[model samples]
Target chain A: MFTPLTVALAVAALALAVWCGWAAYRDQPTKDWHFIGMAVVSVLALAQLAVGIVRLAGGEDAAEGTVIFVAYLAAVAACVPVVGLISLTERTKWGSLTVAAGAVVLAVLQARLHEIWGGGGGA
Target chain B: MAPETPPREPRDPGGGPSDSDATARRASNAPARSAGIGKGPGTLLVTLYGIFTVGAASRSAVQLATRFDEAPLAYLLSAAAALVYAFITLSLVRGGERARRAALGCCCVELLGVLTVGTWTLVEPSAFPDATVWSDYGMGYLFIPVILPVTGLLWLRRSRSHGGPAAVGD
Candidate 1:
């Protein structure tokens, strides 16, 4: 079950990925461009983390809280920087492809995190 | 004939560079990777690997640290896989003969890890009470864990013959 925010972030990332792909077709991806794409992703991830915590705090309970919580933390930290650094180093089309890949991964993880919170046995 | 070495130029200016010369330039530039920028996809792949390493390691760390009792086998394996991802990412970024060799090793292990864990879990469900990154051949991550290593190895092999700095991807 994807949250509204998740859907929004995913869609935004997808759109950016498409644009980045076009940019790659054109050539050297500047750092400023990479920053814009990643900043959005970073914000969304943090929001998911916060919303996740709030929901968890509500005490719905059932899933393995330890595993779920830890995965959530990992998911949040992992998505943002990895994508950013990869783009920073890559000044060509592959960088855009990489961003696209990361975007896809981020969207998927966001959904997974949501499921973990909703208790689909993440822990 | 040795592959033509494209002059060491990181950024090509202006519009769609789909020409054969441009294509050749991009292709030939595979080994020249050192300090500063790399081609886009290489950048992205390296970044993705780095992310995977961090995410996997943290998950393994937390899993092992908090409750080794829960599923020690799976958790320990998860930690090991995370280390491999990190190593591969480093090799990709480092872009050298030795780094390439290290990446090759990591990729081989990754292939083995996914197969071993994935098959073990399926054949004996009792073994994997919880999922690790390689559980089900990284089905959770869309099996990229299985696919990536194969691709990495091929790339490394392909780059070896060319033997140019550009082949390295920084």
Candidate 2:
């Protein structure tokens, strides 16, 4: 895994989380800008997924099992889009809160991905 | 630009929409006529339960498939937790009177599972070589497992009370 990219993804996710959380607290629906923010975060996550896969293809391995690492990568890549769809189903402020929660979960997953790559075993 | 209009006065002391208008709008736009358990805040709860269902199921499945011999008890408990979460998620999304009751029963079972497994793990550390979802009251998953059922039960009660006059008399 690319450490820098992973850290960047985590930071971006955290930023988006805080932004969405504030919007939810204000009882505001998720606006267009929030979708844009989600897109940016999703791009970063996809990039991380690609990089992780490339490293594995080149005979690199995570400290944990390759299957688990790849699973995390796939899950992280899918998280934002899935959450975005769920958010669309909800037009209220709760939609924004759902996105906020998704962002927080993504950030947490990113951290776990980093730990897995750095030889940390099962979380 | 046209001349600026005067700022509108706040509708309520809380600076929100008037209660009647809000209620009327909500009634119109709500997903269900009766505003079943899956509306409004229930959406958020469903999302959360869905996430946990995936988390716990996948974790336990991987563990059982790869190394079940290492900790059968733990993996089995994890699988059980996953099933409970899955049931609750489905029930919440389905959101009828029956579904609400199912979810309530599941939440009660979940709370019992968490408390039982939590105390068991503390009292007999050797029993769980690996952690289950309810182990240590879900300390690994930030205790959301422990808190979720409680929140679910409360929401179920509130939704029941608000269900209708029929529910009130029952």
Candidate 3:
């Protein structure tokens, strides 16, 4: 629910998307470094999830209702790792592109999270 | 994984060395066939469809559960879209001649659904109290609902051709 964290996660996600897209453009598969990038984004997303849960427990409410907000948080936390695993299975340029697609989706979800909270939970 | 092992060539049993060599060369040049439909760009398509499956299914599930009376048609359409996406995603992962054919057929139906829903929403916006995945040609989801089926059809056709080698071996 923190403004800075949401923005940071979106930025990190988009950056990861661009990095993975570049790898695909170079006709390369996802490498160890790309997984590291996924980890970085995942960590931030997990932090956001934690913050959202704690805030909800503290009696704060999301504008879009608690259930959907929590669902989005859980989804955000799970996105990158699952996509990374899928990419790991296929060692080709398309694997890189898959990660890129996942990262872009993560960024979109992050924006929606902000909207779901009514853009009012600023730190 | 597996240390990126070289693609295995099918045994020719009584074929000459030159024939085996040529087969190995061909196999290396087109590994997509051996790897199945889930390889190459299909990997990306599967990922996208997987996401859409989760997105549309969960969204419709919630909508149908909470407000079935308000917009039953739209929510039901959303659920249908989710099923189509899930089927395609599974068929891609379960690669083979039969799975490829099933996916191709589903892709055509999906394309038709999107076009019909898109036009219906445009021509009569008041009819839909809420948007389905295909509403306005998937404008809500960046028009991916329309584009995905077309892409899936192309990929399926290409994979079918690539399956020729594997088919002969089977």
Among the numbered candidates, top TM-score falls to 2
Docking level for model 3: acceptable
Best candidate (score: DockQ):
1
lDDT of 3 by residue, A1-123 (tens): 788999999999999999999988876778889999999999999999999999999999889788889999999999999989988876766778899999999999988899888754544
Candidate 1 or 2, higher TM-score?
Answer: 2
Compared with the true structure, what per-residue lDDT tens digits does model 2 show for residues A28-69?
767899999999999999999999999989998898788889
Any residue pairs clashing in model 3, and if so which?
none
In order of TM-score, best first, we have 2, 3, 1
Model 1 error, position A6 (Å): 2.7
Residue B79, candidate 3: C-alpha displacement in angstroms: 0.6
Q: Model 2, A105: alpha-carbon shift in Å?
A: 0.6
Candidate 2, residues B69-164, lDDT tens digits: the string is: 999999999999999999999998866667778899999999999999999999999999999999999898889989999989988887665442
Ranking by DockQ: 1, 3, 2
The deviation in Å at residue A44 for candidate 3 is: 0.1
Better of 1 and 3 by lDDT: 3
lDDT of each: 0.66, 0.80, 0.82
**Candidate 3 chain B: worst-modelled 10 consecutive residues by lDDT:** B1-10
Query: lDDT by residue for model 1 over B1-170, one digit each (tens)?
Result: 22222334554434333434555466555544322221333456576677678779988888898889989899999999888988888777766556666777878888888898889988997887778998888888888888877776666665565443344442
**What are the chain A TM-scores of the candidates, in order?**
0.75, 0.95, 0.95
lDDT of 1 by residue, A12-67 (tens): 77776676667666564645866776787777777766666666567655254645
Residue A13, candidate 2: alpha-carbon lDDT:
90
For model 2, the stretches where C-alpha displacement exceeds 4 angstroms are: A121-123, B1-35, B164-170
